[model samples]
Target: MYLDDPNRKLLEIDTDTRQGPVIFRWLTLGMEYLIGVILVALIVSVSCNVVGRALFNNSLPWADELARMLFVWLVFIGAAAAFSRYEHIAVDALVRRLPLRIAHMLYLLQHLIITGLMVVMIWGGYQVLSRSSGRSAIMDVPLSFISLSLVLCVIFIAVVSIWRMWVSLNVIRHPEREH
Candidate 1:
C-alpha cells in the first residue's frame, strides 16, 4: 500500500537555511559510500579467508579479526545512512488511521523521542571512543579508530533527526528534486 502524502516534512527540515541541506546531503552521501565500500571489502575479505582456509589450508591471520571489526562498523554506518532516508522501521499502522493533523502530531512526537535517543547515542559513543583511544588488543590498530564509527554514525543520525525536526516546523523548504 502507498500513502498519498508528499512527505516533504523530512526534506523541508533538511533544506532549511540553504546551506543546511547541501551539507547534510553531502555528509549522508559520503557516509553511505564509505559504508558501502567498507561492507564490500569486508565481504570479499571474509570470502577469501574462508576459501583459502578450506582450499589452500592457509588463512589470512588478520582477515577474521578485521572482518569482525568491519561488521560493527557496517551496522552503525548502515544505520546512519538509512536514517537519512527515513528508512528506519516504525510502527505507523495505528497512527496512520488517525486524522491527518493528529497523525502528524503523533509522528512529530515519535521523531522527537528518536532525536533524543540519537543525541544520547552520540554523547555516549564519544565517551566510549575517548576511553578506548590507546586500547587495542587485536591487529594493533587503535581501538578508538575502529570505535570512531560510533561517533561518526551517531553524529550523522543526530544531524538528520534535527533536520527532520526543522522541516516539520516549516523552518526549511524541501528541495525541488528528490535525492
Candidate 2:
C-alpha cells in the first residue's frame, strides 16, 4: 500500500536524515532521554498522589507540584524533539500542491518565521527567568527553573530550524540530488 503512494517518497526524504552538528545530535539524544525520565516521574507522582488519597485519606501535596513541573518540562522538551524531527503538526496541502521550487521557497520562509518566534521566546523566557523570584509552594523550587525550560526549548528549536533551513537551501540549489 505504501509503495503506491507518490508522496511517500517525499515523506521519506523529509524525515530521512539527521541534520545538525555533532554536539546538537548528542544534546538532542540527551533531551530525549530526559523527556522520558520526566514523563515517568510525572506518572509516578500522579499515581502516588491518587493512591495515597484513596487509601490513606491524604494526598502528597508536593506530588501535585512535582507532577505539574514535570509535565511542563515534558511538553517543552517534547516540542523541541518534535521540531527537530519535523514532526510538528502542519497544514501543508498548499505546499504539497505547489511546484517544487515554490514549495522549497515556502518551506524556507516557514523556517525563518519559526526561527524568529523562537528568538522572541528565548528573549522573553530569559527576562522572566531573571526577574522572577517566586518559588513553588510545596517544593520551594524557584519558578525560574520552570521558565528556563522555555528558554532551553526555544534555543534547541532555533538551532534545529537553522540547520534545516541550510539543508533546504542546498536542496533548492541541487534539486536533482534530492531524490
Candidate 3:
C-alpha cells in the first residue's frame, strides 16, 4: 500500500498544505507503480520479439499482440493517473487570461465534462465487454480482458475527478484549507 516515501519533506517545503486526500494519493502512487510494471513488460516483450526473430529465426506469436494490448492499457491508465496529478494536456491560454474566479469556474466545468465523458466510456466499455465475451481471440485471451482495462481506467478517473471536485468545492468555500 505504501508505494514509496513520496518525499513528504519536499511536498511540505513546496506547498502550504501539508496533507492530501489519502485515496487520491494512494491511487496515483499505485498507478505509477503499474506504469513501471507495464514498461518492464514492454521492454521484455520487445526484446524477446526481436531476439526470437533475428537470432532464432522464429518470433513469438503472442509477443506483439500482448505488447500492443499492454500498451493500450498503459496509455489509458497513465492518462487517468496524470489527470490526478493535473498533468494532462490542455489549452489553458485563455483560462490564464481570465480572473481567478472565472478561471476556477472554467476548471470546474472542465472537470465536470471529463467526469461525464469517463462515465460514457465506462458504459460503452461494459457493452463491448458483454458483446465480445467468448468471441475475441488475441493470443488466446478474450477481448473482455482488454475491455476491462477501459472500465478500470474510467472508474479511476471518475473517482479521482469526483474527489478533486469535492476538494475544489471545499477550497472555494474555505480558501485557507487547500491541499
Candidate 4:
C-alpha cells in the first residue's frame, strides 16, 4: 500500500528538510554532502578513464576499480539520506482518514517491519564483509570496504525507522494533539 505524494510527480520523493532530532538532522546533512563528494569522484574517475582510452590510446587501469567503488558508495549513502528524510514512497490517505490511534498503529507496524528488515540486512552484510578477503585487482583496495557501505546505510535506516516508531507512539498517546 504505497503511492507517491499527490503534490509530487508520480516518481518524485520529498526533499524538504523535516523537523527531526538534532543527531538525525546532522547525520542526514552529512550523508547528503558525502553523496556529492562521492558523485564528483565517480565522475572524475570515469572521465579520466574515458579520456585516457579515447585520446591517449592508454587506459588508467585503477580508474575503473575506483569508479566502481565510488559508484557503490554513492548509491548506498544516497539511499540512507533519502530514508532519513522520509523521502520513500508511501500511501497515507487511509491512515489520514483513520482515527489517530489506529493510524499511528499502522505506522508503528510499518516501521517495525522496516526496522526488522534492516536488521536482517545488517546481519547479512556483516557476514559478507567479514568473510571476504579479496582486494580490487587494479587498485588493491579491500573488497570489504564496499560491503561496509551497505551495512552502514542499513544501520542508519534502522535508526531512523526506530525514531519514526517513537514518533508514532507519541501520536498514539496524544490523539488530540496534531502531530
Q: Estimate each model's TM-score.
A: 0.78, 0.85, 0.80, 0.86
Tens digits of per-residue lDDT, candidate 4, 100-143, equal: 67767887898899999999999999999999999989888899
Name every residue pair that clashes in candidate 2.
Answer: none
Candidate 3 lDDT, tens digit per residue, 101-177? 45555656766887899999989988898898673354778878878888988988887666656655554565454
Model 2 spans > 4 angstroms off: 1-21, 177-179
C-alpha lDDT score of every prediction, in listed order: 0.70, 0.77, 0.70, 0.81
Per-residue lDDT of candidate 1, residues 78-132 (tens digit): 8876777666776656765765445555556656887798888878888887777
Top candidate on TM-score is 4
Per-residue CA lDDT of model 2 for 1-179, tens digit only, reads: 53222322232212225544566666767878899899889999999999999999999999999998999999999998776655677776677677665676677787799999999998899899989999999899999999888898999888777876776676678777854
Tell me model 1's lDDT, rounded to 2 decimals: 0.70
For lDDT, the strongest prediction is 4
Estimate the overall C-alpha local distance difference test score of candidate 3: 0.70
TM-score of 1: 0.78
Q: Candidate 4's error at 168, in angstroms?
A: 0.4
Comparing 2 and 3 by lDDT, which wins?
A: 2
